[model samples]
Target: MYRIGVDLGGTNIAVGIVDEKYKIIAQNSTKTKRERGAKAIVKDIALLIEDLLRKTGIKVDEICSAGIGVPGAVDTKKGVVTFSNNFDFKSTELKKMLKDTTGFDFFVANDANAAAFGEYIAGSGKGSDNFVLMTIGTGIGAGIVINGKIYTGVNGAAAEIGHTVIVKDGIPCSCGRKGCFERYASASALTSMAQNAAEENTNSELYKLCGGDIKKIEGRTVFAAIEKNDKTAGEVLDKFIEYLAVGVTNIVNALQPDVLAIGGGVSAAGDVLINPLKQRVQIEDYARFCELKTIIKAAVLSNDAGIIGAAYLDLT
Candidate 1:
């Protein structure tokens, strides 16, 4: 029997049909248009799933189950999204909604955890017994896998490494905490740092790259400018790397996973981010004296990780 997986996000909903081999044979996508509210989006998700089955000629009875990866604190046992700033969701009962409409057993999990599981099963962590995934996008999200199973903690919010405090009272975080790691190590933080540098110096290459529009300074902006030997961009990247190293090293020290794969939009920088991050972790990790160190690398399955991982949620 095939399995269905949905990657539900604030901007879009991606649904996929995975065969027994974990290959996605068919998929569908749609804009979430989140302003429409939870019920509307849920309707769209059910519709999209139906559309996929129709196009692929797969009957509901041939499906093993369906699962969704949400971006908030999820009550996996209850199938509810407790809260999600991105989707503006609050205690939404998603599993029952889908199950009632689609007639398939539904499962739900945090998006980050699904991605980590996907990587562990088929991507960079394929051969590892212990795996950790860190996605550096607008905010940092992490997932942990040990003994071939996800460790969601007793409360289903265990691996939230982004909210961990790294620099007491240094920067404010959306979680209403001071000095959370994401405030300094996230892609948004990198762009903010680059913006400050460009604004402080009008002649900086950063200013030219963004055409004098600081709002256009994305995470890749600094890296592109650095390729041209831009001084201000280099400075911003150096500081960003330092903050990133702190977070990565902390993850290494705490989990000691066999493979710590990196994912998300910022990971597009490839070696530009991984090489330095590796060096920083090597020097900063508490187990530097140990003979074994976690192998840090990019996640091979970019956006598909969520869908594939969700497909295997039942097994996990």
Candidate 2:
């Protein structure tokens, strides 16, 4: 039987059809008009699923189950999205909504958690029972997989590693907490650092890249400057890496997962980012934990992770 995966994001909704081997056989996407309201969004999801099945020439009854990954707090047991900042979904019974509309069994999971499970089963974390999938985007989000399953705590809100405190009263975070790891370790943090550096170092090429407008500087601009061996850019990256290592070290010490799969735009910096993080984790993490050193690697699925992971929610 075929399985369907739906990734609901702020900007777009992606749907994929997968076979038993976890390969995406068919996929499609459409803009998410979240401003339209929750009911409209649910309607859009229904349509997306219909479109995907039609394109794949698969009968509705041939599908085993459909899974949805939403970017917010999820009540997996109740099949509801309790809260979502990207969409106006508050205690919405997503599974029932889709099931009533399509007459198919459906499951829902937190987007990050789903992506982590996807990676664990089909991507980088393959063959490992314990690992963490960290997505470093506008904010940091983590998915914890242990013993070949997603470890959602009693309330289904576990592994919120991003909001873990890194510094006391440091940078402000969207979660209203100060010194959250995301405030310092995400792509947004790097971009903000680059902008501030550009303003201070007028002679730096980053300033030129931003057209002398600090507000226009972004993480990619900083990475480009680092590639050119710009000292100012390198400094910004070094500090960012330090904060990342601090947070990662905590993960290693706490769970000692077999691997830590890093994903998201910031991870695109490649070895320039990985090497420093490795060095710091090696130094700060417990030496006993070093014996079973967690392999730190980039996520292989990239953008496809959410869709692929959503499809495997049945295993959860």
Candidate 3:
């Protein structure tokens, strides 16, 4: 039997059909266009799922169930999205809506937690019982897995490591907190830092890389500038890594997962980001004296982690 996974993001809705091997055999996606509101989004998802089944020639009865990962606090037991700043969702009955539309049983989970479970079962965290995944995109999204289970806390909102304070009274976060880790270490934050550095150092390689248009600056710009040995880019990246390490160390100190994997766009930099981050996290980890330190690595599944994790939500 197969399963279906839906990764509902503010920007896109991705649906996939997965076989027992955890591989996506067929997939479809469409713009979320969240401005149209929640119900419309649910309808679009149902259409996409039907389209995928038609294309794959798989009957609805062939699938066991469907799972959805949302970017918000979810009440898994109730199948409700308790709150989602991205979607403006409040107590939305996501599971019931999806099931009503698709005629399938559904499971709902926080997107990051779903991604972590995907990695734990099939990617970087496959061999580790205790694992954590941090997807550093616009914001830092984290998921904690302990003894082969996703730890969603009593409120199904645990492991929001990004909202944890790194600096006292520092930059403000949209989550209404000051000095949140995402403000400094997220991929968006890295772009902001690069833009600032380019503005201040007009003659730097980073400025030339973006052709003097600060708006063109992105997470990749800094890495490109670094490739040209640009001191400004190096400085910006150093600080970014420092902040990222602080967040990683904080998580490590708290849970000390066997493997702490990094995902999302910035992780595409590979060793350029992981090497330094691993170094800093190791130095700052409270259990540095321990012989078996947490291993830091990049997430192998990339974007597929969320989909695959959502597909197998029953395992959680």
TM-score of every model versus the real structure: 0.95, 0.96, 0.97
Candidate 3 lDDT score relative to the true structure: 0.93
Candidate 3 residues 47-160, lDDT tens each? 999899899889978999789999889998889999987887899999899888888888999999999999999899999989999999999999999999999999888999
The lDDT ranking, best first, is 3, 1, 2
Instruction: Flag the better candidate by lDDT, 1 or 2.
Output: 1
Which of candidates 2 and 3 reaches a greater lDDT? 3
Q: Model 3: residues >4 Å from true position, as ranges?
A: none
Stretches off by above 4 angstroms in model 2 are none
1-316: candidate 2 lDDT, tens digit per residue: 8888988888998889988998989888888888887677778778888888877789987888788888888889889888887788889898898888767777899999999988998999999989799999998999999998888777667888989999999988778899999999999999988888888999998888888889888888988988888999999999999999999989988998999999998888788988888988888978545456888988888878888888889987
TM-score for candidate 1: 0.95
Q: What is each predicted model's overall lDDT from 0 to 1?
A: 0.89, 0.87, 0.93
Per-residue lDDT for 92-196 in model 1, tens only? 888888777777778999999988998898899999999999998888899999999888887677788889999998787878999999999899899889999
Error of 3 at 48 (Å): 1.0
CA RMSD for every model? 1.6, 1.4, 1.1
Better of 2 and 3 by TM-score: 3
Ten-residue stretch with the least lDDT total in model 2: 285-294
Which pairs clash in model 3? none
lDDT at position 307, candidate 2: 86
Report lDDT (Cα) of residue 109, candidate 3. Answer: 96
